[model samples]
Target: MNREKLMKMAGAVRTGGKGSMRRKKKAVHKTTTTDDKRLQSTLKRIGVNAIPAIEEVNIFKDDIVIQFLNPKVQASIAANTWVVSGSPQTKKLQDLLPGIINQLGPDNLDNLRRLAEQFQKQAPGEVATQEDDDEVPELVAGETFEAAANEAPSS
Candidate 1:
């Protein structure tokens, strides 16, 4: 070995015989359940006062109800269908909506539009023609969706 190679090998032995460089990382932690709770509440608002039709069924293995404004359109969550009617016949939204677009034979576009139009008539100004920012408000600090929902008086 040359003089320079001998000196380099000797230096490596003096420093624990390691051959690679690395960086050290610091650990970090966060606590932000507040934002998640806020978003869930906002989705739970909106309207169902004048829905066109509603379907009641067991979904996700739970006795839930799915309200329909049109064939596949829903205005309220499944479990809250009773909010509109005290006693609705057991039915499924799947019973009305075609399983596939092809099943309609590509000739139900007008029927679909008419269904939507009828829904609009039932609930004027309730459709998506305007934004619903005013309908859902932001949650205050230290507040949860369940707490806010429980506090609201049932209509």
Candidate 2:
């Protein structure tokens, strides 16, 4: 019995134990949506080719920056369409201000300080009111303004 048990143990060790006969689970891939498929087909027909070897892409907004590392880019000059696909990291301009200031060095820093001081010294009453300006600004092409009644209330 002891000899038989030893042989069984050695066989189990060689064969990676009891569950080794079970097949590994298949990896599930993401299925593209109908819209994605349609867009890809349309792009192919329109001659929108992939722009390769793009290291990074940055999009700047009023107060934030969107960064994509190793993004895939595609563009068609005729269609005037550009597409960027990647995981984006959003960083606030406020968060980046310190780094920018450090890069500007001491001379620029002094000028910035002086400007800030001047701004602070100005009286609130002296600030320009909307009625004080007579110049009418020209509207840009394809620009439209929302009615004040339709605007959402700020918190």
Candidate 3:
């Protein structure tokens, strides 16, 4: 009857049933605040103590890329990049999110300060206020607060 049917009849292809043979569609995801929390949790679980991306929450098209500085298991400081498709206010990227998050390392104070700088970009209609965090943060992978602080620029 049709090209696919002909192939199937010839045993050149494997059909699921006697009826339709089209593949099932994948589920589409919609981004949510829970997704953000999940992402944060995943990063935390993977030993990625600090996400160094302090840049504006820039979302263009359907992609979000964040870079954080963390110490590797080998005791070295490096920049880690995470590329996420979609946003809490935009699209949802579900399928690949979990696998991407599993690859995380550690954090530092300089990384946090750099990250904190980005909070200045207020969302539309959001009131701005300053609340300082003088306390040192919890360091992962045995990294010290002083080590992270040394990476920050003296104010």
Candidate 4:
């Protein structure tokens, strides 16, 4: 009888069913794009002037660690470091992601937009306009624009 039980236990382990065993798996995520109009309409339903940063597209990652400039977020994470893992649906992990996000405060979207505008302004040459396109003659040569500009006189 003891031998029979031992054989059954060995069989179970070989067949991949053992007590308290967890199968190793990698995390998977889905991504999607939404039109701004649809997004703002959804936010309107929630009575908030703006949507939360973490909810926006391209947010959240597993391999990357992000820091926030906001004091509230900086203080919260200062004490909490252990990650909640195992599964995305696991209540512990699910709860932790949002808490981390909130503590970090709003995503740096505003700062990002400001920086983008700054870069656009600093970009070389005058901003392209439809009027400018009309003012400039169509390309007559196969040479690149820079080559053509070099051949032409400076204003």
Which numbered prediction scores highest in lDDT against the true structure?
A: 2
Score candidate 1 by lDDT.
0.51
What Cα-based lDDT does every candidate model obtain?
0.51, 0.77, 0.49, 0.46
State how far residue 8 of model 3 sits from its true place (Å). Answer: 52
TM-score per candidate: 0.18, 0.43, 0.17, 0.16
Q: List the residue pairs that clash in candidate 3.
A: 47-105, 52-68
Per-residue lDDT tens digits for candidate 1, residues 2-41, read 9999978667555344564433355776658877666446
Give the C-alpha lDDT of model 3.
Answer: 0.49
- Between candidates 1 and 3, the one scoring higher on TM-score is 1
TM-score of candidate 2 versus the correct structure, residues matched by position = 0.43
Q: Write the per-residue lDDT of candidate 4 for residues 47-95, one digit (tens) a residue.
A: 4432133322222454243333221111124333322212122133334
lDDT of 2 by residue, 24-72 (tens): 4679876779779998999899889899999777676866978788999
Name the weakest run of 10 consecutive residues (lDDT summed) in model 1: 56-65
Model with the higher TM-score, candidate 2 or 4: 2
The list of candidate 3 runs beyond 4 A from truth reads 1-31, 51-155
TM-score of 1: 0.18
